[model samples]
Target: MAINVELLKKVCEAPGVPGYESKIRNMIIEEVTPLVDDISVDNMGNVIALKKGRSDEKRAMVAAHMDEIGFIVTHIDDKGFVRFTTLGGFDPKTLTAQRVVIHGKEDVIGVMGTKPVHVMTPEEKNKMPKIKDYYIDLGMNKEEVEKLIEVGNPITRERELIEMGNCVNCKSIDNRVSVFILIETLRNLKECPYDVYGVFTVQEEVGIRGANVAAHSINPDFGFGLDTTIAYDLPGASAHEKVTSLGEGTAIKIMDAMTICDYRMVDYMKKIAEENKIKWQPELLTAGGTDTAGIQRMGKSGAISGAVSIPTRHLHQVIEMANKDDIDGSINLLSNCLESLDKYDWSHK
Candidate 1:
């Protein structure tokens, strides 16, 4: 079960910031169409692909968000420097000195700027960063900037996917990596134990908005949020504080700020992983949430839910990294889990 690195790279590099998800959505839909029996894009912009099963069997769902954290142009100064606001969350420190593409009437390449240290007071050198301290320079005059760029144009980091020794690096890997996992799982799936819905949701960076809408319409007996969990296997982090380690395996969610994975479902996933010889690990995220939370609480009554997380490093940054082994392991584990659901007793006993 090798991950198609080429596919993952295309997904990671696509520019989609919250409200502007059409580009990423079309890419997902085009690739997913051949793998599923039926597919549709809901009004909320969720690309839902379905693989049907026995009439009497329970339905299942898997979701991965397609949106990336980025910014939108708020104003263009007289010097062609652009002021922007984040469409989703970002660590202010990572926003400095990076290049971005402003998606407008025509895509414009720009560089993020900040005051040079040569003129900064010693006290200012030690100061923290604020979004206000940054601006984007498009290298054009005020007339050229205003004539071409709109105030609401979306902006995305200029990044290329790189294959490191054991990992892949790029932007949008937070959820795009999970999107890759879902698509690959569907590609390899032979037959489903029950009807399975694979949803590529939108606006997850702003909130789990698309999932909230999709879950209600395609209510399932069980749900799985395919997403990335933090991997803090670097220096200065204690053992327990490291949510997950890269290359160890696919992460089985136990709990996160948004949802505590159903204990029975957690055991079910672990059982399949062991049976299939797929590497697996447990994750406990301290903050942030996933579409799993939305599906778990959708409709009048919730459904059984859990998440399969790819362990990622440098989350919400320009250089998000995911292990190749983890990607392969997740595809295998999730495919097996989906195929085994019909016979597996979801009962509490």
Candidate 2:
């Protein structure tokens, strides 16, 4: 089946930052309401959808967080400049010269302003850019700025989905790619070999907070955390640290900074990819983590957990990109895995 590129475009551009996911959440609720057998939103704003299987064999949970890294207004200065506390991770170097949308009284467009290089000293030029050095300039004076914005307004990088050759580029692709996978899986999925929980979680960028709550509630037998991993396949990085490259295919995680995957779970996904001839790569991220860690450690005995990551480039930036083929490959592997869950020996012992 053709992946829903139009639906994906809308999802990617949807406005939702960490702890402020209403716009994205409502959009997701609308898209997925009809596809699943049962669905609910938890206190944490996690959208949980369940599709029943032929038998009550075992529950398999897949998480794709809906939140993106963003900023919240902390101060509106006298000169109409806005200072904010970052809601999630952003390289200060990339913060400068960025166009952003501040959700104040109304949506206001602003640029992250920084000192001009011509006025910098030699010492300042050699130093790294600090978050304190940057502020959102709404181009309004103090009176107008104070009247329009508040101290707690959220701000997000302003970007529209851009199709670049065979790839799609935009912000929030880190988790939105996974969200797309879950939505399409449910839309296309008719029968499951086992009970499936598709969770579109909130606040993953701040922490795996939503997933933590969802996993505890479900106490799944098997868990798959879907997310995007770094594809440092650029000019200067080594292949060893490239993690997973774009266009290669889906990523089967072996290890990352947060969790060492269960061997059987890793083997399970990898084997499925191989048998089905789905393109995939083994991911070994040296840093960062996904909800897989939180899911694996849930309940008293915990659950068998693993991950399927979309190989992506320029993670956390407005220019983040992922290949169409890789997205298709992940969808294929996960749907196939869900349909054939009973076919595998997923015993804990």
Report the lDDT tens digits of candidate 1 across residue range 77-118: 888899999988888888889999999898999999999989
Tell me the TM-score of model 2.
Answer: 0.97
What is the alpha-carbon lDDT for the whole of candidate 2? 0.89
Q: After superposition, how far is residue 176 of candidate 2 from its true place, in Å?
A: 0.9
**Stretches > 4 Å off in candidate 2:** none
Task: Give me the runs in candidate 1 sitting further than 4 Å from their true place.
Answer: none
Clash list (residue pairs), candidate 2: none
lDDT of 1 at 324: 97
Error of 2 at 19 (Å): 0.8
- How big is the positional error of residue 2 in model 1, measured in Å on the Cα after superposition? 2.8
